[model samples]
Target: MVEQGKEQETKDFHPAPVWLDESYLEPLLRDLKKDPGLRITELEIKPATAKGDNYASVMTRVKILFLRSSAKIPEIEYYIVKTTYENDPFASDIFSKYQVSTTEMLMYEKVLPQLSALIEETRQPEKVFAATLHVDYEHDAIIFEDLAVSKHVLADRLIGFDLEHTRLALRKLAKMHAAAAVLNERKPGILTKFDHGIFNRYTKGFAPFFENLCDVAADFAATCPELGDHYARKLRELRKRVMEYSARVYDPQPDEFNTLVHGDFWVNNVMMRYGERKEPLDMILIDFQFCSWSSPAVDLHYFFNTSVQKPIRYEHQEELVQYYHTVLVETLKDLKFGGYTPTLRQFVLQLERGGFFAVTVALTCQAILTNDQTADADFNALMKDDERGRNFRKVLYHNKTLQENLKYMLPRFDRSGLLDVID
Candidate 1:
């Protein structure tokens, strides 16, 4: 009886490898074979590099050797398979929202192909707007062409994107935005087909954390007695607007200049390929899980406030905006889009609209972004998330990187009148 029990226990044990489901993989093989007409005679799956946000990721590098009926040489291709945590429901929910994976699926399958055709029609250079190999929405999984094989590398977020990188990213951004404008113009009801926005609700229960963070900011202000009252009043007023401002961009505005935003357009999501002279030649945007239809400014402010470092932001803020406008106008003209492009003053107004949201992120997320997050580790190295809420306020109080960024940003906010939160 004892031996039988042991055997039964052993039989019940089954390991879960979410990235290696045979049923989900057949479609990928079929898609791949359509071009080369070859079979993946053998393949192996192993873990690949991954990072943390909320997704409980199981990333696998798939190596495949193709078998052809009559081939001169055998070829090996590579792919990366990514999926949510199969074992942890709570973790999966935290990382993803109601239909985040499905949003990404639609972007890859429907939207990107249309964008690619536009790119070809307009006689543009590259299709850096999209990069997706295969997707399985039901499984909350995607397979990507191994970027390393294509000699592309993820830009470093800690150091931040320089001027050239900014231009490159923004140019591609403008092209996609141009496409969105034309498409929306043709059918007024089209943009609404996309999801509301990405990570817009990640700021849930932001009050407790914002209140605690205000106390921390007040303590810092006390050190400079001259600025104490100014900051104290600012923080107090800001506490009221934390949740409101963070929740502002969810719905689309019919009257405004709404365009699709790669909602999480930041340094890390951009991949670059350097030329012979060691300069960035081309770039590709990845991770459309946060794609949304909103003011084009949402993406603009996101890139400016999160990715661009202090020097570039201080020196070239206006210049960069102008440069982006120039590219956007040119691309729109190329597409035979006759609609009115927003003027420089109008663009600045959009920046002001997104400023509060930008400030909130800078105050709450710098530490998380600056930390050395390895594959096994996450952004919450110094903080944690639980039922009560995220411990971001504690990080604001103690984290050096967060403190330094706030110091840099607060003065700029005051100068620009962005801290006039009461109005």
Candidate 2:
């Protein structure tokens, strides 16, 4: 969506609707209290996140000063309001095809509460998610308590996560998966509608986006002295099968461990709270718009390739996977899970089977996440095959850090047979 009332050169962002005001929020506020006399004294709205931090929704932070009773002091509340892009053809198409907004609303309205209750039932100390305040289905808006109030901050996407952050994230991820698996067993169809992940049979909206990014990767491979004709040709051919490759990798196999995965489990979606020593004390995952009922291995690959810092990204993967698998199995057993739990060998085998996913993320999502020139990047600039899109891709592919990451990763991917196209 293009920002209105600006020159062609200005960056685009989805603006909050004209209807968002004190009157529209009063009822939602009252729902939080039993006091019919609750009155909003003041309310302020501003852009919640910086450009390129999030893309699926327009994040607007609403700060409210309200009085629950005349006898009590007025209280302040901060909420991050998420709303969909309106009237834009691309937004309309993607939302309609995938029902992402609806799915996310369901997550907040139904799934997350149950997951939190499950953790509490087991008396586990793991922090699972932020508290959701409201879900406005009519307007496609979700109001969440701003985690910043609790001193939770997002790990640096450009710099990537260190071993501690990665370990904490994987541990929390395991708890979530374990709980969801048990929850699903109790309620068979709870996770049925969560199958529309980024790569699914329901839509091809990202096909062109991936194709163009792969092209950029191949072009970079050809230009870099270290990666000459051979890598370039491999990247080019791999570009053709991007969709099929991801589809196969995402497809769940029988007898393999599967549960609800945070499909976009990258740096942006993970928020961490640290201690005085800056050690990660807890991590909470956000953005359920891309959740899928698939092997947790896909999520593990996605997080490692796109979010972990390069120093440990490659060498320490086995350690991270083993730690996660151990936590997963322990949590499942603690929860009295009746289903088949995959052994470390089976889980590692599944991770290997889905190894191509890491390559896809490195070549596509990793480059986007690590690019610092994010102010001008948006859905239009990244998806459309126009001059603006091409220029944005140039900035993304040519990022110094991204180039270095590719240089270090391409050969490893080649060795893993991730670059080869299977007939």
Top candidate when judged by lDDT against the true structure: 2
Determine the backbone clash count of candidate 2. Answer: 0
Give residue 367's error in model 2 in angstroms: 1.1
Q: Which regions of candidate 2 are displaced past 4 Å?
A: 1-14
CA RMSD of each candidate after superposition: 6.5, 3.0
lDDT of each: 0.65, 0.84
Off by over 4 Å in 1: 1-27, 35-41, 52-59, 69-73, 94-98, 199-233, 249-251, 373-401
Expressed as tens digits, the lDDT of each residue in 247-314 for candidate 2 is: 77767666788899888898889788889998888888898888878888779989998888887786
Name the 10 consecutive residues with the lowest summed lDDT in model 2: 4-13
Q: Which residue pairs show backbone clashes in model 2?
A: none
How many clashes (backbone N, Cα, C below 3 Å) per candidate?
1, 0
TM-score of 2: 0.95
